[model samples]
Target: MKTLLHAAGLAAWLAMSQASAGISLNGTRVIFDGAHPEASVTVRNHGADILVQSWLEALDSDKAELPFAITPPLTRLPAGQEQLLRILYAGAGASDQQETAFWLNVQEIPQAAGKGNVLQLAVRQRVKVFYRPPGLDGDALQAPERLRWRLRRERGNSWLQADNPSRYHVTVTGLTLLSGGKSKEISRAQMLAPGAGGQWPLPADTANDARLRYQIINDFGASQAFEARLQGVAPAQPQRLEP
Candidate 1:
């Protein structure tokens, strides 16, 4: 446990120093290997002594319970110090159909010093945690690029479907439809795992042959753009990739 803790701190410190100023995470995302008992995350405290709290919550509460726990849920993080946190999956069982996505919330609480109406706000950081079962096929890094986009209709209702065929999770950060020289951005933020899919209701007047341009959240917590056309139409080629 101690070694795991040490490793967690190192990872957090390396990943978050410049981008996150006061507190940084070791990695952009947490991948929990189901064959193992737990995963590790490091939190580095670059500011003054503060209290840090963390927890895990499931995205689809209706499907399964949030079965993960973060050790040392709340602790005093001394200035210039770092600590490794453990995420243990204690749920009934891992999802067999697809990778389960959860949210890891880490909040930093700073003391309030009354100095002329000072505002001492607590800064909370949230990151995606993907629970991957053993024996899942395909590479996670390629999952985003492998996603299939299509326009579907059922009972006179049209919707945009994004199917994930890879054995990894794809986090869609932004989506838009293009048709008749008109572009409409769809508001959606969800992760689709291997063998799973997501559908967004399209506007009643949306073009049936509209193309889709979406952004996937990469491992670094950054968005990467990609384009695809409806299933029956010719594929929409990508323009330029975001660096």
Candidate 2:
């Protein structure tokens, strides 16, 4: 029986996550600094003959202020081949106070096979593109440590509130709240916007004083762990874990 997978799989992938993709990016994410003329990333194809189309997309609701230009937007990628995607910055119009975030979408176009019942599929991958402007206020690495946390209870619901006061985006990858004897694990990656505070609902919270262990993804996309004592007002900042 002939099977169809191109549209349905692509739609499901867009709504959710996929186990794997036909093409892989060399880096986890891309960082385009304002001081540099451009940035590039390596895209390698698996054992599939497909067309790779890459383009920059705006993450914000307003799309009038884009400042990036991608080269080789559409190219034919053979089996087990690789190519370099160059991202040239316009060098203007981005905010100088805070880092801007964008989405780089790499989509795979499936080629037809000369068979009777072939399962054709197309895959897509998205990576965060962080554009750090020149003369930013704070360092990207130190932005995680500057965060403060406190347990907020409102309307019979307990939430872990995280306050970020830095100019760079801080992505929280792992979190665990430990009480006297019980521990609740929160395993989700959430990006805290610059100069903003966010709250995540807690499964349970009954400790008088708890230890908050949180992990953040750094500039290179590596997870680093940190811990702090949860307070009524978050007096103590997060301390980095010692290697």
Candidate 3:
């Protein structure tokens, strides 16, 4: 009954192997914009039990471990079902060109099992950052004057006037809107001489709740910019003048 015992032992080993199962991760990739980056992975479970826990890993070209590894939230996958997991890389700084090599490590904890299994998946992606440079005009170039905007009259269309003195060949560059808790680029122009500094006609439906920033650029790549608040004020009603 030595033969019978040996056969029984082999059957038990096969049964144990079949019982311990895991999920497979496929089609892993990292996506990066100039400002933000994200990772996506596809998980497929082929075992008879559910998978409850999972993790990921990222590596460089030399197989060195990355300082930042994303662990997706714990989830359960029914047997033979698949799901997609996503992770975001929230880093700072603006580098135009940086190569980020990465990969995925998917771990699955099977239900009613004491130990979990891990699967290794691979991925690679590059990062790109972008920015704009300030522009300049001819010799009459000087640092752009700081703009202090004031409201003259409130009417149908809002009007804004800057207390700036016009200088020849000195144009404004890098005029931007840093309002609504966000930054946005604006157009540039050369101010004509002999008049009130510069006037920006506020558009109808314009919310006077943003800070304006502007810069003066010279021919030599030199620039200066400043910020000013666009304080909210009550609109004035049109007054009828006696003839």
As a TM-score, model 2 comes out at 0.85
Candidate lDDT scores, in order, read 0.77, 0.83, 0.48
- Cα deviation of 75 in candidate 3 (Å)? 1.4
Query: Which residue ranges in model 3 land beyond 4 Å of their true spot?
Result: 1-20, 28-37, 58-71, 93-96, 113-243
Candidate 1, residues 176-234, lDDT tens digits: the string is: 78887998888877778677888888876677676677788877777888877664423
Between candidates 1 and 3, the TM-score winner = 1
The regions of model 2 sitting more than 4 angstroms off are 1-21, 60-65, 203-205
Q: For residues 1-243, what per-residue lDDT tens digits would candidate 2 score against the true structure?
A: 124577777677655434445689988899988788888989898756789999888887578757788889999998989989999887677888898899898988878878597556678889999998877877888999999888877776788888899999899977888887888887766899899988878754456488888889887878899998986545558999975
RMSD of 2: 4.9
lDDT of 1: 0.77
Cα RMSD for predicted model 1? 10.7
lDDT of 3 by residue, 36-60 (tens): 3555556777765555454444332
Alpha carbon deviation, residue 31, candidate 2 (Å) = 1.0
State TM-scores per candidate: 0.73, 0.85, 0.33
Ranking by lDDT: 2, 1, 3
Model 3 vs. true fold: TM? 0.33
Best by TM-score: 2
Q: Going through the candidates in order, what is the number of backbone clashes in each?
A: 4, 0, 0
